[model samples]
Target: MSKAKKSEFRPNDYVVYPAHGVGQIVSIEKQEVAGFELELFVISFEKDKMTLRVPTNRATEIGMRGLSSPDVVSQAMKTLKGKAKVKRAMWSRRAQEYEQKINSGDLIAIAEVVRDLHRSDDQREQSYSERQLYEAALERLTREMAAVAGGDEITAAKQLDEVLLSRAA
Candidate 1:
């Protein structure tokens, strides 16, 4: 058997993982595992105190991707303001589908989840699970957008909301 070639990853790089949102690459490390050496990219998410080690070469295959471009993030923000598409399906089924999209690490897909699940101030109440998923998607999308725009998450989120609101009106 042959060892796989390691792809180069740098510190301060923004990356997205399926379940976790955007994270910054802290370091690249080589460690011995079962008498073999493995190279890993250390990624950290401050919001969760979670660290992930992904094999350099396996990053893309596992849906790990760099921060989306500013244009891409802007497009996703526009998506948020678009008309909501609430399915007639059961809540459980819809929630599962939304979770899958979030974990896919696709900004547009995550934005779709956020848009469809978002409730306006005057809207009816959202179920606990719905609220949780909505917040998660919003956070994930905003973090990446902020990184791309060279701004903080709060600013990015507010910008996104502004775009959406303007589109809605």
Candidate 2:
């Protein structure tokens, strides 16, 4: 791999880790391993209370990126407003796709998962796994939305819920 681009991330910058949602860069450290010097970015996932160390050289390769632009977030919100498109496929197959979308770290894809999985007050209830995936997708979307919107997670979540609820109505 060509040497990773110079670290564009700094301490306190919010970044998205494809599999983990949003995290804050806590620090950059240099370590010596196997006679090679390596630089790593230490990131903290507040909601999960988990810390991750990613090699600075591999950050881009791993899909680590900055928060979405406001335009992207707006597009994601619009996605939530679109009609749900549940496939005729088996639930297990759909669930797997939803999981992949949530972990892809793409705002619009996560929005699609939220759109498809959301159940209205008058609609039939979701199965246990459906509800789990729905919550997971929602949480991931909101975390990135919060980072981009300059608000806390709760407010961002409420905004997302409001958008989805309006569509449901």
Candidate 3:
């Protein structure tokens, strides 16, 4: 079956951003930038405010999509529970790749990075940078999940941890 076209966007619609966490579509507006007329989506989160502008027609192509279905979020949670891959490669290189994946706004890829970098309660220390990246990935992934699951950020974060712990055991 063909998918229906979106005729309008409402406030509080969950939207996935490339690098940041899932945000609510707070408003839509038209503005002139560089002397050209443009339309933009204003999204807001508890942590930050972001504005996303697409050529209006190219929004879908840029991966600016609505929140995933519950089933998709469940699959991402399952992915989070899997084994972590620690490549022997250098940290700087791996960090760059992780950043790219997070910005890609692919839920599964973000989950993988979060799972791989996640440290257990008893695990050894993480470098300052590693901790930073881990937090960023986790936040990005969970924000979308929360929006999909119809819950607040704290609940969503806890749910993600539960899935990881269940699989880790």
Candidate 4:
């Protein structure tokens, strides 16, 4: 690898880790490991109360990405307003797919999960697992939305609720 280090992210930048949703890059750290210098990004997930250290060289390789752009956010919101698509696959298979989508860290994919799994008041009740998946997806979607809009999760959630409720009508 060339000694030229071109980093696209800096401290305090919000980024999404595929498996961990959104986290802020608190700092960039350089440590010596096995007689070699390694650079890492120190990320903090406030909502999950977790911190992660990922090698800077592996950020993009591991699907760590910056927050969604405004257009992407709008596209995700449009996805929420669309009809839900629940396949006829078995529940277990569908559950696994939903989990995969949640962890993919793709805003639109997460939005689809939230839209499909959402159960309005009059809709049939959801099972325990279903509710868990929905909440997980919702949380991921909400966090990214909030980060993009520079608002709190609660406000983002309310905006999402309005969109979903309008879709149901």
For each candidate, give its TM-score against the true structure: 0.91, 0.95, 0.85, 0.95
Poorly placed runs, candidate 2 (over 4 Å): 1-4
- For every model in order, what is the number of clashing pairs? 0, 0, 0, 0
1-169 per-residue lDDT for model 2 (tens digits): 4455665888899999999999999999999989999999999998899999999979998999889999999999999999999999999999999999999999999999999999988999899999999999999999899889899989998998899889977
Better of 2 and 3 by lDDT: 2
> Which 10 consecutive positions of candidate 1 have the poorest summed lDDT?
1-10
Clash pairs, candidate 2, are none
Candidate 4 local distance difference test against the native = 0.93
For each candidate, what is the lDDT?
0.85, 0.92, 0.77, 0.93
Candidate number that wins on TM-score, 3 or 4? 4
lDDT of 1 by residue, 11-120 (tens): 88888887797898999999888998998899999888989998887887787777887788778877887899989999999999999988888999999998898876
Better of 1 and 2 by lDDT: 2
The C-alpha local distance difference test score for the whole of candidate 3 amounts to 0.77
RMSD to the hidden true structure, all candidates: 3.2, 2.0, 2.5, 2.5
Comparing 1 with 4 on lDDT, the higher-scoring candidate is 4
Provide the lowest-lDDT 10-residue window in model 2. Answer: 1-10
Q: Please give, for residues 60-87, the per-residue lDDT of candidate 4 as tens digits.
A: 8888999999999999999999989989
Residue pairs that clash (backbone atoms under 3 angstroms), model 1: none
Q: List ranges where model 4 is wrong by over 4 Å.
A: 1-5
